[model samples]
Target: MTARVGVVTFPGTLDDRDTQRAVRTAGLEAVPLWHRDKDLKQVDAVILPGGFSYGDYLRAGAISRFSPVMETVIAQAKAGMPVLGICNGFQVLTETHLLPGAMLRNNHLHFICRDQKLRVENAETAWTRSYEQGQEINIPLKNIDGRYVADERVLDELEAEGRVVFRYEELNPNGSLRDIAGISNAEGNVVGLMPHPEHAVEPLIGTGRTDGLGFFTSILKRLVSA
Candidate 1:
């Protein structure tokens, strides 16, 4: 059976359609999941796409943490479901304590939009398996609050555990600590990143590079093999 991946749409979400297109391009079924709905529709994996959830009011993702859908997502994620959070979705993941660290405003205090270079520091996670360790990829990144911050000890622990999945290469746009662009949970089932991989999945879009297709393909491979 073809794997089904859920792309969630919160009230202020803006990338659900692009994410769904990416999933379909990777040969998976893209299931639209509503923030107000409790059911997951039996999706094999879940993706929280980039967007200003709840208009990023009260801080990005602070309010979306309490959404009803998150209850099921949190439970399923804890039970080993693969969950990928992008941009604003990453903010929500941190707020829900599914991932450590907080996203602060850009160091320059301005929204940035560009094709970003990132090194695949750890490719063993469910969402990054298609990449080779240390490989570099270019994906589009756009956001105002994109700086990732964490306590020193927590950062050390993540580094020690090989959970820093992606690191900014060459250019650190938001002054994220240690150039950290993304990280995965200890179990490797949950991943949250600032770049919008879905935007780079098609050759005709963005930089005309499909480097981000690996993320979608990675999850599809895992689901198929399981």
Candidate 2:
């Protein structure tokens, strides 16, 4: 059976369509999930696309954390379902406690928009299995509240567990703690990052690079082989 990947659309989300397109391009069915719906349509995996969810009010992903869909998502994720959160979606993962750390304002206190360089620190996650460890890729990252922070102990734990999946390579764009750009849960099923991978999936579009397609294909490959 073809892998069915769900792309969630919260209110004010800007990249849901892009995520769907990327999923389709990767040969998976793109199931559009709504914030108000509790059902997941039996998708094999879920992607929380990047966008200004809930208008980023009360902080990014803060308001969206309470959406009805999240209740199911949190439970499903804990049950070993693969979940990938991008940008503001990353913020939601943190708010929902599915992942560690919090996103604060950029150290520069400015909205940054650019093609970011990130080194793949861990390529064993469900969403990154197609990448080689230490592979460098450029993806679009545009956000205001993008700084990642956590207590010393939590940071130490993440580092010690090899949970830090991605790190800024050349320059840290938002001063994220430890130059961390992405992380995965202990099971490697839940992954969250502050970059717009969907936007980088198409080659004829912006940077003409298809490095982000690995994320989508990785999940599909995992589901098929399992």
Give a tens-digit lDDT track for model 2, residues 1-226: 7999999999999999999999999999999999999999999999998999989999899999999999999999999999999998999999999999999999999998999999999999999999999999999989999999999999999999999999998999998999999998999999999988898888898668998999999999999999
Q: What is the lDDT of residue 218 in candidate 1?
A: 97
Runs in model 2 lying further than 4 Å from the true structure: none
Candidate 1 Cα deviation (angstroms), residue 151:
0.3
Quote the RMSD, in angstroms, for model 2. 0.7
Please state the error at residue 166 of candidate 2 in Å: 0.4
Q: What would the per-residue lDDT of candidate 1 be over residues 8-83, giving only the tens digit for each residue?
A: 9999999999999999999999999999998999998999989999999999999988999999999999999999
Model 2's number of clashes is 0
What's each prediction's clash count?
0, 0
| Local accuracy by lDDT, each model | 0.95, 0.94
Model 1 TM-score on a 0 to 1 scale: 0.99
- TM-scores, each model vs. reference: 0.99, 0.99
